[model samples]
Target chain A: MNTERLTEPSKDELASGLRRLGAMDPGPDFAARVMGRIGTAAPLPAPKRRMARVIGWLMEPRTIRVSPLGSLAAAACLLLALGLFLKINPGAESGRTPAGLSPVTFVLAAPSAREVAVIGSFNGWKAAGWTMRNDPATGLWTLTTALPPGSHEYVFLVDGTTPVTDAAAALNVDDGFGSRNSVLLVKNGDGTAL
Target chain B: MDKPDNDRDDAMAVERTLSGEREAFAVLVRRYQGPVYRLMLRFSRDEHEACEMAQDAFVRAYERLASYDQRRRFFTWLYTLALNLARDRARRVAREPLYRQDLDMTLADPGRDPLASLEAARLLDALRDLSPKYAEALALRYIEDMPLDAVAETLGVSMSGAKMRVHRALHMLRELYGKEGKQ
Candidate 1:
């Protein structure tokens, strides 16, 4: 531990310095000023609507809090998480998606590619009909598919040859090979845009 | 992540918060707001910006509550968020670096009303002259009387790093005091 040598200032000197530093007062109504901002700040209008607010509130990080109920919820969540983690194949395994359904669109900017397939937790990482075609004139590859509504990790197999990742998505999971696969977490029964 | 009783308390709080118990969060805000505000004030030169950043940090923390690791102290996480926001604000304003300073009067005027106590005002001014990092370290370590490990966690630095910051800050403070004494 890098403890500082507490300089032995004369008592009078130290007391005077301490008194000087201690005078800066907390602003009156400091707490009120802080609390006033609770729900008033106008978020991006488009994302401030009722549904978005609800989704954001539910998925919001601060809601988890550091309180008694929060701890219980956290414990339950941890247990649930542990259960889910343990139930899943813990070993080196092929991509096996859980049972559910979520609609996802895979986009690739490979104008030069003839094909692109998605392989991830959704379809056992298989290269099949998941390959998408470029709208040759537009130079962008696009494929929309129904994935189970949950956290599904996926990536594009460009030209059925090169595996490419999504740049625009928010969540991503590492794909063991020093690369990452884009993750789309579709909340259960919510068609909200991430 | 302390004892079972504490864990129970945390869990109960978590449940209330998740159940949309607004006051539960308020309880948390009231509890940790002072530390968070002070930390921000150390980072941002102005009280208004510090208040704004601290508020933003709380809002952001509230939004990210579900991801809160229950084992950790809420204040530590909130401090990290507040510090990050202050850093972001600093970057946007193209402010001086954290540990480097021009020793300007950027701090003498914290707001309209000056501190009522003369001695405290001098100390506050001296503190303000230090770099944000050093000032924050000193405030957290000395003013707040936080333990070394807690200070480290709040500052998001290793224990050794936190100690170094505090050490350097105090050394500078002593120097500033020496200059004042000479004067």
Candidate 2:
């Protein structure tokens, strides 16, 4: 057997030799050729229509949905229906009131000289027949109107148009856009009056 | 080795390509095509097959550029893909006895002195006689002048493993040369 020590080649000798053996210069126009092929190759088709179809299917009814706007609209309609029912049916138990029945009563207090009336969500907030005469001796104005034992709001009319709130009213609600309304929550059949 | 300067350059080129300069991608294709093609040739053992595999690897790399973890070595990833394709080709070759006659010296150098070309061819033939893994290790080590670690990365193995493969290949080559001397 031939026995000889193997010696390592210098870096320069190794590099130039490998270069000559085709380790470098991949070929002329290699990059341009590759990029040209890539550019000219047919592109993958997009799935926009398929995606839109999927979205449409998902958005269809009977699928899961959390519609805040629809829920809000339903809530508003429910509230409107409730308000209408409450207006038409003030006292749920009794509908007939004697012309002079006067069993239902409404009042508003004005310490100064003025006139008062019962006006509410029930009677469209008018003060026609239910006006109170001011007693000059006591300087207090009081009105009593036969309301059908349900919730209503009333206030004092200082000459004709100026409406004053009743300080002693048991119920008051803020009118939200920055005004105040006196609310009277009257539960009928409990023998309560306001 | 050079503080990943070439890799940084590759990433910049990739970025430029994605930013609508398709020409930038060509620069990358040009730069790495040699290594990638050589690696594929070692695997396929045929120029045409190697060229096809290399092209496939590059196209695949371009398509999946977005998924490439730029923090890692790009060639390693590309070579892995090319090697896998070559392995598939090898498996197919093993299954089917489809062989082409080895390129003759006459064809390799039609005009050059036949004796010198024959010596270079002899060295290549000796290298090819080694097991595929060992031959690849030797080729990448001496022929390509790649670092042991980079060769391992390309071959998808550990450094010590690649080092051992190269060491074993050299021992085999010496033994073969010794045998030739005795004859």
Candidate 3:
């Protein structure tokens, strides 16, 4: 650390001098030049209607109808059909993965951690809604979540602040912000990782 | 207009500009052109480049006007945009030598007091030597005479972080100025 000497200007003097340094005259034509360019330049495009606003409006319920028994029956049939389909056509089940999604299990041994979450390109780098559950006895935190297939970079956020990369991951990439993120290649369920 | 009216007027200009009144943007440009150009000059250290960068900043602000949060001070957003532009320009021109012997010849006015000019030049040189973060904080807090909260908003830092940067920058500047005086 560089220490200030007694001979140096006091902070107040420096501040006052800086303030008095004043704005440089950008010339008499500055504003006119700016206005001219703005006049000639293309106008801003109108903003696109946001999908989130539409979704929010759609999510508001106007009414509710109860059909518990019928809904339960339909749900049971759907589950049975899904199970049979998975059993009979394992390859098809994997191929049918929704929009390149695949199940992945992330495990971390953190004895001191109270809470952990996963953040990555898959979740738009957000730390919410992807929390991991911890086993108190083994002191192991685990998260099983579906991620889009292909190379996805992620980090384990510990206690909502510390970003820890997985040591077990053989692949890692620089996040371009002075941090490394663990890279995971989700397979297409064809026994080959992308 | 008084200070509060001027601020409210700036916001009103933004609203008008966004509502297809293209001429209203000129009001904002005129209002802020001085500080914006000066801020750029602090980073670029060249008057022409500063002018161009200030123009670029205003153009960008106009293009991204819809994203501006009206609750915040308009200059904060504009200053932040100009600083980012300056940083990008600095990075792109990092390989090139910034200081030129002829700079004084081109910039200095013969009629002006030589002593004041020399002092200003020395001050600018010292500022250039400081870290970019420190330079930016000092420029915003002192040169622009922004309130601490406004400085924090412009730099995307906390109020305390802004304060620390200003304090550290002043200390660094003092030390650098002293060393220069010795020579």
Candidate 4:
């Protein structure tokens, strides 16, 4: 029972009993029964004769909504693919990495930033020797780091001051500074697992 | 448990179900069956009909998943859809619901007070006879234990409108109940 209620029902047995009635369950196997007959009838929008149309709409392709961040991420993936095509490995991607390391690429769309650095647990959280290159052609900041197969925490330092976490990160945690830090898991022998 | 959390999970389920994962729709059916079934019982106290109506509601929702507005709470949209189905079924099928029989069976317990059950039954009878709008307001507010904003959302009305409907319904129910007392 919630002690701090936002609204009060009538203070009477009828209302109280009605509240108690809310506990009633629909009974077991209810979900199983519903699932057994979902596809029997066509939707009101689609008549039976238009089965091919339904299949066409169901199989329709969708496009990504382009945004600044989205464009930067796409550019990063393209750049990574190109790097792989040419077998290009920017050496010393990060300060320290274990044996059998993979180069991981990170990107941020900070067009106005004068400088950007990659700071994370990988390089002792310091913004030294981990500077990301700025692509003036696209205004996207990017860095490729070679790391072994393991989990890592990282954040982008825009203009060497403010920290920005990747919005598309699979997981993130509180940075204890009223902000978030992104987590990245490097897959098997893949460089720039952005 | 929180509204935002439920909304996020439901949005994901809706997305997955839309993207050819038929099993994701089952997760939604399992999550909301109890509430949908209870609401159906308000329209027809028969357990079998309530279950059927609930199943129909989920199927209809699955068919219309594309039309669901992401702005509204998924449960609110589902409850409103179920309510509309119940109303549509009532109009199509002319049959009196077995309210008293189901109530007796529900309230029959060894340690339960017989008098309390009788009063509950009488109140439910008045509830059934009440106008559909008022009856629905009471059911959503009390039986569903929904907050005022959620009740408003489910009823497709404003906050004051929900409050007015609930209070008026309560007043009508009390008068009808007093008549039951006299009899």
Best by lDDT: 3
lDDT of 4: 0.78
Q: What share of the true interface contacts does candidate 2 keep?
A: 0.21
TM-score of chain A of 2: 0.41
Residue A23 lDDT (model 2): 34
Cα lDDT tens digits for candidate 1, B1-183: 444554466556655776667556666676666677766666665556667777788777766676676677666666767778877877787544322132233234455344333334445556767888887887777776677887898777999999999888787877775565455
lDDT of 1 by residue, A70-176 (tens): 89998999999877876563321323334465445577787777777778887888987677756888888766666666677888887667877788878778878
| Chain A (candidate 3) TM-score to true chain A | 0.48
User: What TM-score fits each model?
Assistant: 0.45, 0.49, 0.58, 0.53
Q: What are the chain B TM-scores of all models? A: 0.71, 0.75, 0.86, 0.85
> Sorted on TM-score, highest at the top, how do the candidates line up?
3, 4, 2, 1
Q: Report model 1's interface C-alpha RMSD after superposition on the true interface residues.
A: 5.8
Quote the TM-score that chain A achieves in each candidate.
Answer: 0.45, 0.41, 0.48, 0.48
Q: For model 2, how does the per-residue alpha-carbon lDDT over B59-102 read when each residue is reduced to its tens digit?
A: 87777676666677776776666667767777777522213244
- Residue-level error in angstroms, candidate 1, position B178: 3.5
Q: What's the count of clashing pairs in each model shown? A: 44, 1, 0, 5
Clashing pairs in 3: none
Ranked candidates (lDDT, high to low): 3, 4, 1, 2
